[model samples]
Target chain A: MNPIPMEQSLMVAAMLFSLGLIGLLVRRNVIFMLISIEIMLNAAGLAFVVAGSHWQAADGQVMFLFIITMAAAEVAIGLALVLRLQSDLPTLDVDAMDQLKGGDDA
Target chain B: MFWLTSIVAIVATLLAISRLNATHALLYLIVSFLSVAVLFLQLGAPFVAAIEVIVYAGAIMVLFVFVIMLLNLGPHAVEGERQLLPPHAWIGPGLLAAVLLLELLMPLSNNQFIPTTGTAKHADHSTIPTIPTEAAPQLQERMVVGPKEVGIKLFSTYLLAVELAGFLLLAGLVGAFHIGREEPRTSAKPGAMEVPSQEGPA
Candidate 1:
């Protein structure tokens, strides 16, 4: 069996990032977009772990642990804000979020 | 081949996301995640493969299925709209698969194909052979850590991060509960009762 190389890890990470980016761009649902963002974060974490493994240091994994923490914090705050927005507008259509467009404030 | 499995996984994932019915979508998603876990296992990252199964296929999909059951959406959600749209959803995966096939076939550039070139100075001496395959079997064996090493690494070096991850997960549960708040509509009052739609706030 061939030992996995860092390049292969990078390729997997690239696939994940591309999929996530496409989802974020194409999907209309904010929740679905949030899931895509989580996927992207996971791709980054995987790359970090792979790099760390080659170096024989656990530092990269430690950093990924922190990255996961940040992602959790972000989604918590983000979803809360989304809840407030939904409560007021009662529509999750991100396009309508243009209400924050100059038209509403003006 | 591994490429075949990867392609299948990608196709499954794309189908999972694009399906109109929520339940079918979740089902396809489970297939996709499981296949990706297999890909990870083939990559020799058994640890990541386990996480992919446990965290994604097991926990996250359970959450999705729970939400689907809670919603109790009407049967055959796409029953009425049979005509207007062309069969476009199928095309998306076809196009993606084509691109993936191209990527799989393409050869790597110098940066990717270049060897690591380890064991330089000792390579000259007869002690270390130029070709690794010609070397001693004892030296060629890879180092593998048992569960003990993993435990030590997790608790000793990563204790703080592990504790923090637990706290983050707790907070996520609370946040999900709060954000996913549905009106406790135990009893429907009347016709004008406002049931929330997906169009509800961002």
Candidate 2:
């Protein structure tokens, strides 16, 4: 049997997820927002691993592998977009990319 | 041991998200990932723990650092980050996250919600014996789900998902290449003048 209870382990994942959510909501930098999204994905992976351990199943780890794969792909595209954005814009501030915010009217 | 690592992960993650410098935040995030890998180890998912360290702390973080360096963010950028994140900026999100955390924890704290321990479905599968430690006597005879079983499951049950993941990665690679490539200056813009000056030298 594992020493720590499953609930407590899940609580840790929850806290991490919440922190990531806060980061996502507060940070204006696109890179920081991407980092926050990574944190959230990691937290979700933690929860899956914990549940797998609870049931003594390998399915959780399989899911985690998928998560890691998805995160890798996402980071690749996101960083590429960031590079493109940096080349076009003077600043990395997300608010600066407001060309689509307003309608056709001035 | 588990609690210690969990605390470290949480604290490191908190510090990571609040940093003004991108590189500094990435470093803290690495530390946080390492701590979580330790947690994965304690949970008996050694395979996952190793991947966590190798991919998260090693590969992904290196990618982040490379991008930050390529961007060459100066002190002015750090100053801009500070302006973007004032002391007052944290209040609303912090409160919202706190409330979400409370909601997640309230049920977990209740005794009635604790899951009952039962025999594992794969109890017959081979498990590596763990050495008894003074700190965690209960983990002495715990079942360790090693990489062998995970590999079997991946190939047998999750083969389709693996193929899909590979396809997704390929698509991402092509997309990133197209998006990241420098565009030719064919448009009638100010930068179009510079294109001929570079070609004249050749």
Candidate 3:
């Protein structure tokens, strides 16, 4: 059996990335947006591993490890922010938090 | 075979991103991650595949579910979410996917997509004095990465990176702790009445 071509794996990564980008743009809920970001990050990690395996080098895997670590840290901060927002705001909707847009005195 | 698994993962992700309910979206994302893990295995990175499953699908997904539960977005919120998913939601993603698909397909169209030549080394070594049945087994072994290689390379070449990652994790822990802590009630209200600390709410 022929080894799967590197192009094929890269194509899958692109598709995943695109889907994630769309999700990030379309999802209004802050939590859903975070999930989209995670998807995009994972897709990037997949690309690294695929490239590394294609070239027979361990560097891709090392980068992937770093990506995972980065992702974990990101999610921790993101979710913490979400929790804080939920507590301080009346609603979790992104539009509702537009108070930062310079308000007219109430 | 790889195509099949990847397609499944992509479709699951599509379903996930389109869903209005946050929990439902997360579940589909988990499905997407699992299939991607399989794709990683097929691509000859078993260690990364395991991490994909354990960290991405298991631990991370569980954390998302926990947050969803804690937020308690009820049925009314679900209704609002549905309204938020307008028809235009598909437009942005579709356009982006189209552009990316074109870029990815270009290499294949030009016949520039070369299979990794490194496989030749493994093939050469495995072909010597191996029985026909044993050939498949040896090839399979060549495809997988051992944890030992990953560990040695990680500690030796990427040692400083590993240290930085640990430091990053510590920072995340501290940040999460600080952000998630409850705020103390202010005691400076002039006209407000204060109840005893042991007393329950009236």
| Most TM-score-accurate candidate | 2
Each candidate structure's TM-score, on Cα atoms with residue i matched to residue i, is 0.59, 0.74, 0.73
List residue ranges in candidate 3 displaced over 4 A: A100-106, B73-142, B186-202
Q: Supply candidate 3's per-residue lDDT for B110.
A: 44
**lDDT, residue B85, model 1:** 34
Count: clashes, candidate 1: 6
Candidate 2 CAPRI-style tier: acceptable
DockQ of each: 0.21, 0.37, 0.33
Which is superior by lDDT, 1 or 2? 2
| TM-score sort, best first | 2, 3, 1
Q: Top DockQ: which candidate number?
A: 2
User: What clash count does candidate 3 reach?
Assistant: 0
- In candidate 1, what are the lDDT values of residues B1-202, reduced to their tens digit? 3465456665665665566554555555566556555554444334444566676667665655543343332343254234213466445545544553443333222121111112222322322224344333422342211223334567788888789788887887787667555445423322212344324222
* TM-score of model number 1: 0.59
**Segments in model 2 whose C-alpha atoms lie over 4 Å from true places:** A100-106, B73-126, B129-140, B186-202
Model 3: TM-score, first chain: 0.91
Please, what is the whole-model Cα lDDT of each candidate in the order they appear? 0.52, 0.74, 0.70
Write model 3 residue lDDT over B1-202, tens digit each, in one string: 5776787779879988888777667767877887787677667666777788899988888788777666664445566566545566555445434443453355335432212122223433422223345244535544545344677789999999999999999999999988766546523221111221212121
Cα RMSD (Å) per model? 10.1, 9.9, 10.3
Candidate 1 off by > 4 Å: A56-92, A97-106, B1-5, B14-25, B72-147, B181-202
Docking class of 3: acceptable
